[model samples]
Target: MVISVKLLEGKKVAQALDETMAKRVESLKEKGITPGLAVVLVGDNSASAVYVRNKQRRAEKLGINFQLIRFEESVTEQELLAKIDELNNDSAIDGFLVQLPLPDHIDEDKVNEAISPNKDVDGFTPISVGNLWIGTPMTKPATASGILMMLDHYNVDLDGKNVVIIGRSNIVGKPTAALMLERNATVTITHSHTKNLKEITSKADVLVVAIGRAKFITQDYVKDQAIVIDVGMDRDENGKLCGDVDFDDVKDKTSMITPVPGGVGPMTITALVDQVIELAEGRING
Candidate 1:
């Protein structure tokens, strides 16, 4: 039996979300409120720069205010913390985040902690993470929320489903598990040390791969007709962009799968901008 594989393209999902977000932004404008978002980028990481640019474009396109704060690689930890304090009190800013992988001198934890929970749109603060697991999320980690948003867009029901997540990082794997568990799905998280990895992954109704290695999850790791979400942004042996799942080798076996570049990437910024707008909406309703 030949099964037609459906592509869960995140760009398409993001575009659909943009239309609604634009209307919401316009409504807030009519109420004299503008959704404001800021991103603090430290050092000169090319990948981080690209991610921040994409975010700026998306936020401005949706009519939300976007701010980019750049700091030199040599900036001290205290200097970064001072800026975080300023943004924390900046009424014009609704939500903000400091890009990860700060230089060796700065403490990433100290920076994340400095951002007030109310303005932690990146959802990395302890308070935000605590809220998410308890099912009263103030702001969700964008990538995990993006994955959930995509599944919801495709009408893939999660209740009582079995979900297996590859990688255990705070950004994707663990948070994705928390959100999926909230939907009543049984969640399992695996890392490099797990024994019989394929046996574990093959049983999942939905599989999410965020492991950094390129093409780590090939056809054998996936079960027939399982919904696969790949969160990896990696370069293949040929120096081209690819995902953790080998798309060519695994696409035919899946019912719905997200492509490498177009899949989980776009939804992330969408979720972030949406969170800022949601917070702005709160300003008036309260």
Candidate 2:
């Protein structure tokens, strides 16, 4: 029996979200409210720059206001906090985020904490994360929300299923497990230290891989027809982009899977944009 696989493309899911956002933007504009998103990018991280550019492009295309606040690598932490404070009070600003991986001198936690939870569209603040974990979500972490969108888009049912997630990062892995559990699936989180990782992963009815290593979960780690979602954006030996799952090796073994460039990546930014709209509408239910 030859079972065909479904590739869950983020581009398509993002397009669907784009249409929804466009309508919402138009409605808000009629009421004299233009949703705005401010992104604070510190230093010169190439990956962060690319991500910011992608976000600005998408925002502009949707007619949403996008502000890119650039800071030098040598900028002081106090300086960033001051700027965040200003944006917090700015009435026009609906949502904002400080891009991660600040330089060694700055405290990432301090910056995240400084941003008003009311304007914390990144959903990294203690208040936001806490709200999400307990099920009454005010705002969700973008990547995790995006993963849920993928599951919904592909019609993958999670109820009563064993969902295994790799890499327990705050932004992706942990929040995703929480979201899956909200959907009634039993979730297990594994990291670098887990014993017999494959033994654990192979038991999953749905597998999500966000471990930083490129192409880490090959065919052996997955069960037959299990839906796979790759949350990694990594480079291969040839300097080409890849994901946490080895798409070439594992695609045929799954019922559905998300690819590297077009998988969870696009949905993440889209989810961020959605938060802005939700904030403007006074409907921030995560």
Candidate 3:
């Protein structure tokens, strides 16, 4: 007897999410509320450009008003903070986020603090994170929220499951742990210096890897029939795009797994639009 493994494609999951939100987006427009999202880019980083472009494209498709505010590398921290204040006060904008990896001169934490919690669709602000921990989150961090949406769509029950997340970055791991805990899953987060990494990972019912390594989590690290979510975007030795998990090596061993390019990538941007729509709706109701 053979157990057939399943692939959880993120592109399809993202599409389904967008489809569900399409009518809601149009409904906002029907009521004279056009959801708006703005992305502020401090410098021209290649990776940040790719993310911004993806968000812009998806926002247009979903009928959300999107804007990219580009600033030179020399832009001062004061200038960036002031701009965030402006956007926060701008009634047209429902939500906004400053693209990460801003110039070294700018204090990233301070910038996040400057964005109004109501408009922080990226959910990086202290207020947003605090809300999440208190069990009454307003807008979730997009990537983490997107991952949860994917898991929920696939009917992956989180109750009482052991979830081990291998990246502790604020954008992915920490928030994701909070979400799993919300679902009654026991969560453990491992970072760069984690000892006996494989031993811990092998016990997880669900594994999510986002450590920015290429093919780092192989068959040895994953438990049999575990659900794997790969949040990495990396290039293999042959210049082929791959995930942190070696999909070919680990796919057969897992009950379900998400691929790199078509997996978690698509859902990130879709979640952004969903947050903007929610913010816009709230504004209208208030």
Candidate 4:
């Protein structure tokens, strides 16, 4: 039985979403508003740089007023918090995010909490997370939201499906579980310490992997005809980009799967900019 596999190409989905979002930006402009978004980057993390670049390009292409604030690695915690306060009150900027993995001297949670819940476009704040679980999200974490958006674009109904997410991070795993639950799917979240991981995964109708381990999940862990969404952005042994699930090793057995570079990566930025646009829309509604 040679099962045909469908690739959940997030790049294509992002392009399709961009068309509608761009029009929304244009409409806001006609009403004397241009959606504004900003990112604050500290130090020089290569991966963070790439993520920020992708976001800037997309936001600008949609006619959003994009801002990038750079801070030195030696900057004090108080200074960073002060900047956050400024952006929180900035009327022109609808939403903004501080790039994560900040230097050891800075407290990440403290910074995230400082961003106003309304402008917490990355949805990392406690207020945002609480709201999400309660079914009234102010904004969603970009990567998790993107995953659902891609699934919806493909018309993969989550209702009554068993979703096994192989990560428990606040960013992806927890939020994904919350969103899937709202759609009436039964969700299970597993992490590095999960015992009998394969046993749990092999029973899922849908599997989402975001453990940051290159090619960690293979066909052995997947159920026949299951849908897989890989969120890993790790380098393989040969220094090539690859996902948590080994595409070649698992694709033949799965009904649908996402590729390493063209999958969840692009959709993340699409979801980020979409959140910014929504906040901008609110400005007009009030």
Candidate 5:
């Protein structure tokens, strides 16, 4: 007998988040403290450009102040850092993000560390990362937070569950593991270097794939009735969006799963907006 997987609709969750954020933004506006986001994009990665553009457009729609700073690929590390410094001192900018996948010559860690944690809305700084582990108030990396938000929205409880995440990247895997641990889930993190990845993933009650490879996780990697969340968004040979998990093959085996395009991606931006509103309200009035 084949089982049909329940779709975890991130678009629906994101809309709810937007409604909450919109009201918060309006409240801030009424108090004369307009929440703002400053985005700095280095180089011309097509995908990054599109993401930044969407963020700016959404910020405007919510009546939040938005700024986008574009720099050439040849821009020096010091030049980028200088721009971050300027935004850091600007009182009007409530949150700021330095877009990722920076140029090879630039030290991404240095740039991330340089941003003031108060305005580091991307949540890449060590301070924010530490706060997340400690359950303190800090902006979390939006993608990681989005995953948790989606799980909660679907009424999936993580406590005491065996949650296995594929990938060890700072942006998604490591932070997400920390979040699951905070939720009392026994979390296991695997990477390319891990031997017999399937054995580990098959034991999970919840499986999150963020390895960035298209359709890397198939039905064989999942346990029956496992909750699957795919964080990878890559175009397959057919030019359609595909995720790390083979949706068609694994969906039947899972209890719930997030789709490639409409899942984690949309929720991430919504999470960012939510955090920005929280930050603005906390700093200005709380």
Candidate 6:
């Protein structure tokens, strides 16, 4: 039986999230407690810069307090930590994030650990990671949270399903697997060193690909009627945005799938803003 994959468009999902955020922000504004997000960008990776800029623009359009801080590649690690310290103590800054893929000399883990958990809206801190594992009300990594939101939006039942997540990165793969487990899905995590990857993926009721490679998963790796979630964004040979899975090849074999560029990307940002608002509200009431 040939299955036609239903497209899970992220733009639509993101718009819905933004609308909800707008209403929540209005409520906060009326209460005279505006939620603020501070984004710190180190070095000048063109892609990272563009992402930060887009985030700032979106935050402004939504009337959320947004601040962007840029630093040169030569900036010292201590300097970056100091800035984070300042944000941590600043009551006006509800949440903040330090952009990823920092320079070689800087320890990413150290920086992530330095951010105060309450202000760590990026959800990269150890405390936040622990909260996610314990199923507490803490900010989760936006990408992981977005994937969960997408599943909920589509009404995908996760109870007792077999979920196979490719890649074991902390940002997306591992946290997502934990979340799936939380929803009662039997989760399996695969990485580069895993054996018989195709065999594992073929058994999955839900397949999430985040290996960060271009068009890596083909038709053979997917099960018939499996829900495929592509979390990778890569530029193809023609400079078109493509996902980790070969969309054309796998579309007809899956029950539903998320499209690249328009799928997981937008939802990630939306989830970040959502968490920020949630944090602000919780802080005020608690």
Quickly count the clashes in candidate 3.
0
Model 6 weakest lDDT span, ten residues long: 1-10
CA deviation > 4 Å runs, candidate 4:
none
Q: TM-scores for all candidates? A: 0.97, 0.95, 0.96, 0.97, 0.94, 0.95
Task: Candidate 2: list runs displaced more than 4 Å.
Answer: 283-286
lDDT of each: 0.94, 0.89, 0.91, 0.95, 0.90, 0.90
Residue-wise lDDT of candidate 4 within 1-286, one digit each (tens)?
6568999999999999999999999999999998999999999999899889989999999999999999999989999999999999999999999998899999998999999999999999999999999999999999999999999999999999999999999989999999999999999999989999999999999999989999999999999999999999999999999999999999998999999899999999999999999999999877
Give one digit per residue, the lDDT tens place, for model 1 in 1-286: 7679999999999999999999999999999999899999998999999989999999999999999999999999999999999999998899999998899888788888888999999899999999999999999999999999999999999999999999999988888999999999999999989999999999999999999999989889999999999999999999999999999999999999999899999999889999999999989866
For residues 1-286, write the lDDT of model 6, one tens digit per residue. 5445689988899898788889899999999888899999998999999889888877877778998989999999999999999999988888999998899999999999999998888887889899889988478888988999998999999999999999999889989987889999999999999989999999999999999889999999999989999999998889888999999999888998999979999988888888888877876786
Query: Residue 85 in candidate 5 has what lDDT?
Result: 95
Ten contiguous residues with the weakest lDDT in model 4: 1-10
The better-scoring model by lDDT among 3 and 5 is 3
Residue-level lDDT of model 3, residues 1-286, one tens digit each, is 7879888888998888888788898988889999999999978899899889989989989889998899999999999988999999999999999999988898999999999998999998999999998888988988889888888889999999999999999999999998899999999999999988999999999999999999999999999999999999999999999999999999999999998889888888877888999999997778
Model 4, global lDDT: 0.95
Q: Once superposed on the true structure, which residue ranges of model 3 sit more than 4 Å away at CA?
A: none
Colliding residue pairs in candidate 5: none
Please report how far candidate 3 places residue 216 from its true position, in Å. Answer: 1.3
Off by over 4 Å in 1: none
Candidate 1 TM-score, C-alpha based? 0.97
In model 6, what is the error at residue 14, expressed in angstroms?
Answer: 0.5
Best-performing candidate as measured by lDDT: 4
